[model samples]
Target: TQLLEQSPQFLSIQEGENLTVYCNSSSVFSSLQWYRQEPGEGPVLLVTVVTGGEVKKLKRLTFQFGDARKDSSLHITAAQPGDTGLYLCAGRDTGGFKTIFGAGTRLFVKA
Candidate 1:
């Protein structure tokens, strides 16, 4: 089984600040996804990267998939208080639908 490790388990920043969180794994994944979960709620899918070296942007957030498909990152620009949540990275192996999830990075954006 592949295990994903997320860095900087917690982050706290003021509104309008920029921050980047990382997710890494030794094993390669066929696809990876990012999600954000607010208190008392399940995580919400943010984006999925299926191709190596692929970069995708959603508004002020940028998602990048490493060339080897073993790592990924998420950068949020000018983060707002509304952005505070637990960020999770999940990856699926090439042979199965089972997804491995990182411990998650808890972000607190203060207004």
Candidate 2:
């Protein structure tokens, strides 16, 4: 099993604001993923970073993988009430099927 640590466990922002959440770990992963979740439902896959120094964008959201393949970050621009939810990061083991998740960042956006 891999371990990922997420920062700023909670965030509250006003509409149109911007925010970034970070995930860090000492172990390298074959691939890492980011997810967004709403109340009473399963999380939705946002992006997956598989290579070192790779970056991906989903609309106003940006995701980056560390050069060492051991860390990642997610940035969201122009926050909205609809964007409010729990953001999570997971790392897949390089040699097995194990996947580990951070506790998650709960975001609250006020309109």
Candidate 3:
């Protein structure tokens, strides 16, 4: 079965910090998606990198896909209290419409 596992299930940092989260799996994926969720709201798509070795950035956040398409990472620079939220990584199987999500990384940026 294809699965995505995320590291650092929880994170707490003072405002203006930096951190990196990892997502890994033994199974290859056709596409991978990253999301950020705030309390009581559905996750919002942060970015999606399809090709192996692909990299994308949004503001202070950077995302990278493994060359083998089996892993990914997210890096945040100067994280603020507003950046505090749940980070999720999801992988889509090539053969179907199913998407599997990682356990998630919960971040807390103290003011």
- List CA RMSD, all candidates: 0.6, 0.9, 0.8
* Model 1 pairs in collision: none
lDDT of each: 0.97, 0.94, 0.95
Best by TM-score: 1
Task: Identify the candidate with maximal lDDT.
Answer: 1
Stretches > 4 Å off in candidate 3 = none
Best-to-worst lDDT order: 1, 3, 2
C-alpha lDDT of residue 52 in model 2: 98
From the highest TM-score down, the ranking of the candidates is 1, 3, 2
Those runs of model 2 whose alpha carbons end farther than 4 Å from true positions after fitting are none
Candidate 1 lDDT: 0.97
Judged by lDDT relative to the true structure, which candidate is superior, 2 or 3?
Answer: 3
Clashing pairs in 3: none
Tell me the tens digit of each residue's lDDT in model 3 across 49-87: 899999999999999999999999999999999999999
Return whichever of 1 and 2 wins on lDDT: 1
* Cα lDDT tens digits for candidate 2, 45-67: 99999999999999999999999
